[model samples]
Target: MATGKTDLGNAFEDFKLGQRLAHATPRTVTAGDVALYNALYGPRFSLFSSDEFARGCGLETAPVDPLIAFHLVFGKTVPDISLNAVANLGYAEGRFLAPLHPGDTLSAASEVIGLKENSNGRTGVVYVRTTGVNQRGVAVLSYVRWVMVRKRDPAAAVGEQSVPTLAPAVPAADLAPPPGLDFRKYDFALAGAPHAYEDYAVGEKIDHVDGMVVEEAEAQMATRLWQNTAKVHFNQFERAQDPSGRRLVYGGVVISTAKALSFNGLQNAGLVLAINGGRHVSPYFAGGTVFAWSQVLDKAELGGPGGAIGALRLRLVATVDRPCADFPDKDEAGAYAPGVILDLDYWAAVPKRG
Candidate 1:
């Protein structure tokens, strides 16, 4: 008889509703990680790139990019939650509770919240709520994501489905700025934009006016840097069965790329308050040049009506090899235009010029 020693991660049937999972390998974020992340995505947000600029905004030092912290937490769950995933579907109710700085040790945990078998019987959707925390056990980030996973046996029975009800968006009152964060002393010139919170109005739109090509090497490296173990991102042979015969770029990469490009106009919109909802509309492969545009969905006064901080609800859209000059988006009938790859709705904290 052969002994089972090798660990093949969980399949569809392995997940049970309400089961909690403690992910391994805690990572202490460092300045080096910050530097590498900058190199990878080239985000020019002053709050993340310059400590002096961050100090100007009343933070102790430049905090790690919220998306970086998010990716780190999401990556930790891949080995256990999505090793056999067909695709990551969408995200909802994501909120950044605290800022992560260099030297902060980060870890993650998840609870299986929902499960539903697909009609094909070869796959199922798994919904998990994952939380990342610092060494002191304070929750830094929390969100819900669902993924399609392959089943080990097509005939295995999956019991009744249980999908949790999620809010369409995080309430404005729930947006939290980092402790001691006072944007009254914000520097517009140094931050790359002079626009303040009041300059933007609801329903207004802006074209980011930049394009970035997704290189295969950089995409793979960025994914590995987060310790993401998704096979579709790294294994060419496994992806050979597909028509493209190329590995798929992680959706988070597109989000960061589109965000970096947004710096052209929204430079002072540095702090990400919440990711209410997002979707990866299409698969993005290496070599596609990505472009972006944004529309102001709504706005709110954070801290108080006359406080130094405020928030903007923005709908960020990304398209491949297509300029956002025309604002390519879903039509009245509810369908995204061609080349449109990502649709992200989130809230960002910006300074008040007062």
Candidate 2:
């Protein structure tokens, strides 16, 4: 029994530049997966909710939420990449390349892209590009993320640093249109909002008034459902040593919650095309009510065979206990408020219904 220890995880000393890892446990997405996703996040976008609605717009059936694909792929990388992480730093160059349907099996692999040891000699940031592929080996999702990982030994040598220069945004031309997707017949009433691409101007702010308090059990269950192996989120004893002395809420939980709340105003902007960048501004724990808001940063027309498909650049913000009534963001001097827990920039597909 003393000799039977599992692979704990990779520490900073264990990572080699350009190393590759094929994650385990390919998941076959099912209607049950989609249903559980909806139950956890409460996403109300009609395209994901109604098979008939998706067919009316040209697809045969509703695809699972893109965030589901994102989280599933992200969850796969935890054991190999972030199991020993101090924190997940940021994300870049995320794009959903294809629709993920029920019964499609998803597997993931990652390549180490960058590493820089901290000056304190306690931790280092590891950057990796993760690609999610279906059963046929067709890539469905791709993205880059950096995480702060602890060093097994403080005296370990700092390896070659290869911080990657990631793209600031995904180009409009590169946005992948779902197969046979056309929004020409999109119904604003059924989607829950009448705002089309033309209705939202750049710099427009939307306060998602609703707030949901995350309970400790709810957060743990959600993380477990994703199969994330990050120890800090699961081991109460490991979290006791953390500065906060509490199990931190996963950033994805905040994102899904905020995205669900955004339905009050951005019901039509349901499809997440890409993640340009994101930051967990600060660590938040259970028992705080989360509120959210969004700002339209930019917009472009992605014309498809179905006619005009609109893509909007949105900045989503999430705060703990503080409602985003005024679209709370960075202060005039350029610092997020104490309550702000997340700052995310992404592209969403919106139907042009006029």
Candidate 3:
């Protein structure tokens, strides 16, 4: 079908290896965006929640949560990259390079690094590495994501199969915290967590012990806040053909909600340095309650023995309608529990005891 003037977006067959797409829309971060994000996710990370606390730790003011920046940047790619996508498969090698203040403007661009048609021939996978840059053209965030996209014509022949080899996790040495960041004088009393970097041990599990119900209004509002235009998230008529006959909740919503819920136990580990990898284990819909748990996979000291900051490699899992007291997870064969919806691996900056 010809879209003519209306721009229906690119199909799998329309993409070619090495294609570069400079996505449209540059959005300036704002106080309203920050407030709305906080309202939606209820994140209580002191660094992002209080300007005074941020200044005490050496920032000019509290910065927007890194995930907000991630969502904004990721949302910009949807029109050109995944408007016709069946689903976003996974994310890898994501790094947050800079803090985004309220006034900073963000834009994105992506390079098609790989492509392969599915054996079934109805759809294919597309790999792209996207870079989000601020107004000065400095890259603020970078990540690689693959999506399953529908083909315009099932009979169309795909030229070649190229899959990029991704590192299992970002090396700890490569993680970057903001410049001038010093937790030496960090106020643990005001931060709401007595436990610092020294208190957590590798292999320890922390049940966030909280759950938040996903409401239809808030989920759609969050997707719109990031300017995400994915049809599956909003077009009921388009989704009517599917068995569920409902709009799908955006995966980013689950990530943010689960991260917010983690604050109860991992309050000190607020600043995310890098997302090693993540997967939407299953589809989530509105009206389901989300619960989460975290396990410390690894840890690193950033500056030295006397360094003010450290990093924790964490596995954060979110499950629908299931409390995490039992730590619901994959079995020996790696099958997730029936309620599991998200599994995320990432490195976070935590303040060391000063």
Q: Which of 2 and 3 is the better model by lDDT?
A: 3
Q: In lDDT terms, how accurate is model 2?
A: 0.88
Q: Compared with the true structure, what per-residue lDDT tens digits does model 3 show for residues 1-354? A: 776789788889989999999999999999999999999999999999899999999889997899999999999999998898878889999999998999999999999999989999988999999999999999899999999888989998887679999999999999989888988988998989789889999999999998999898999999999999988889887641236665788899999999999999988888999999999989888888999999999999998435879999999999999898976488888898789999999999998886
Report how far off residue 32 is in candidate 1 (Å). Answer: 1.3
Off by over 4 Å in 1: 1-3, 239-242, 304-306
lDDT of 2 by residue, 201-240 (tens): 9999999899988888888888888889898788877642
Give per-residue CA lDDT, model 1, range 134-185, as digits (tens): 9999999999999989999999888768988999999999988888888877
> Against the unseen true structure, what C-alpha lDDT does each candidate score?
0.89, 0.88, 0.91
Lowest lDDT sum, 10 consecutive residues, model 3, at 237-246
- Ranking of models by lDDT: 3, 1, 2
Stretches of candidate 2 exceeding 4 Å from the true structure: 1-4, 240-245
As for candidate 2, its clashing pairs are none
Please provide TM-scores, in order, for all candidate models, with all chains considered together: 0.97, 0.97, 0.97
Backbone clashes for every candidate come to: 0, 0, 0
Question: Over the full model, what C-alpha lDDT does candidate 1 score relative to the true structure?
Answer: 0.89
Error of 3 at 119 (Å): 1.6
Worst 10 residues of 2 by lDDT: 237-246
